[model samples]
Target: MALKYSNKINKIRTFALSLIFIGIAIMYVGIFFKQSMIVMSLLMIIGCLATLSSAAVYAWIGLLSTKAVQVTCPNCSKVTKMLGRVDACMYCREPLTLDPNLEGKEFNENYNRKKQPVNKEN
Candidate 1:
C-alpha cells in the first residue's frame, strides 16, 4: 500500500478552513434550542471560540510560511515552500528533500522528527 502525502502548509490551512465551517455549524445548531437562553449563549460562545481559534491557526501558519524555504519542485517545475528536511510539493505532491543523504531514499515523515523510536526485538 502506498501512503499519500500533502503539503504541510496546505494541510494546516485546510484544517483551519474546516474549523470555520464547524464553528458555523455549531452556531446554526444553537438555533434549535432558542427556548433555553443559557444553552444558546453557551453554544454561541463555543462557536465564536472555535472560529477565533481558526483565525489564530491561520496567523500561526502565516508566520511559519514566511520562514519556510522556497524551492522549485523537480517533478512539477513549480515553486513551492517547504518546511524541515522533507515535505511534499504543494502543487504536485512530489516528495522533496534538502539533505543530499536522503536523496533517492523512500520518503518518510519520520525524517523531521527530533527522536527516532526505538526498535524493540524479542
Candidate 2:
C-alpha cells in the first residue's frame, strides 16, 4: 500500500485551526439552550476550554518550530520546516531526508527513529 504523507507541522497547525472553528461552532450552538442558564453556561465553558486548548497547541507548535530544521524545498522552491529524518515539504508535499544514505529511498516514517550503532571494528 502506498503511504500518504503530509508535513507534520502543517498537519498539527491545521488541527489547531480546526479546534478554534469547532469551539466557535459549539459556542454558537449554546445560544439555542438559552432557556437553561446552567446548560448554556456549561457549554460556553466547554467551548472556551476548547479554544484555550487550541491556543496552547499553537504555542507548542511555536516551540517545535524552533527545533525543526528549515530547508528550501526543491519541489516548490520555498522554505519549509522538517521535524525528523524524513518529512514532507510544507507547500508541495515532497518527501525529504536529512541522511544522504536514505536519499531516493521510499518514504518511511521509520527513518525518524534512532538507529542502533553498528560495530565498525567487526
Candidate 3:
C-alpha cells in the first residue's frame, strides 16, 4: 500500500512529546528577550500554554485508551490497542482491521471518513 500508517495512540503520544519539547524551546527563547519585559513575558506565557496543552493532550489520550479495543496482533502475536476500524500493530507495525470486508484491501485513511449514500433514480 502506498499509504503510510502508524498506530493511532503512538501518533498522538509522539505529538504530545513534541509539544513538550517545543514548549521548552520556546521558554528558552524567552531568556534571550530578558532586556524586554513584554517580549520575555509574552514568550514565557506562550511556552507555558504549549506545555499545558500537551498535558491536556496526554489526558485525552488516557481517556481514549480506556475506549480503545485491545487485540492480539496475529503477525507479531503481541497485544495492541486499536482506535478505529483499522490500525497498525503497536509492536510490529502490522496493519489490522476489525472489519472483515476491508481485509486484504489497500490501506486508506479515507476509509475512516463517513460516506454518504448515493441516490439513484430509475
Best by TM-score: 1
Considering lDDT, which of the candidate structures 2 and 3 is the better prediction for this target? 2
The parts of candidate 1 lying over 4 Å away from their true place are 1-3, 118-122
Q: Clashing pairs in model 1?
A: none
Error of 1 at 79 (Å): 0.5
Residue-level lDDT for 71 in candidate 3: 99
Residue-level lDDT of model 3, residues 40-112, one tens digit each, is 9999999999999999999999999999999999988999999888889898888889989889976765666
lDDT for model 1, please.
0.92
Q: Give the winner by TM-score: 1 or 2.
A: 1
Better of 2 and 3 by TM-score: 3
Question: In candidate 2, what are the lDDT values of residues 13-79, reduced to their tens digit?
Answer: 9999999999988899899999999989988998998999999999999999999999999888999
Rank candidates by TM-score, best first.
Answer: 1, 3, 2
Residues 1-122, candidate 1, lDDT per residue (tens digit)? 75678999999999999999999999999988899999998999889999999999999999999999999999989999999889999988999999998899789888888895554652
Query: 28, model 1: CA deviation in Å?
Result: 0.5
Alpha-carbon TM-score of each model against the true structure: 0.92, 0.82, 0.90
Predicted structure with the largest lDDT when compared to the true one: 1
Give me the displacement of residue 71 in model 2, in angstroms. 1.4
Error of 2 at 10 (Å): 0.8
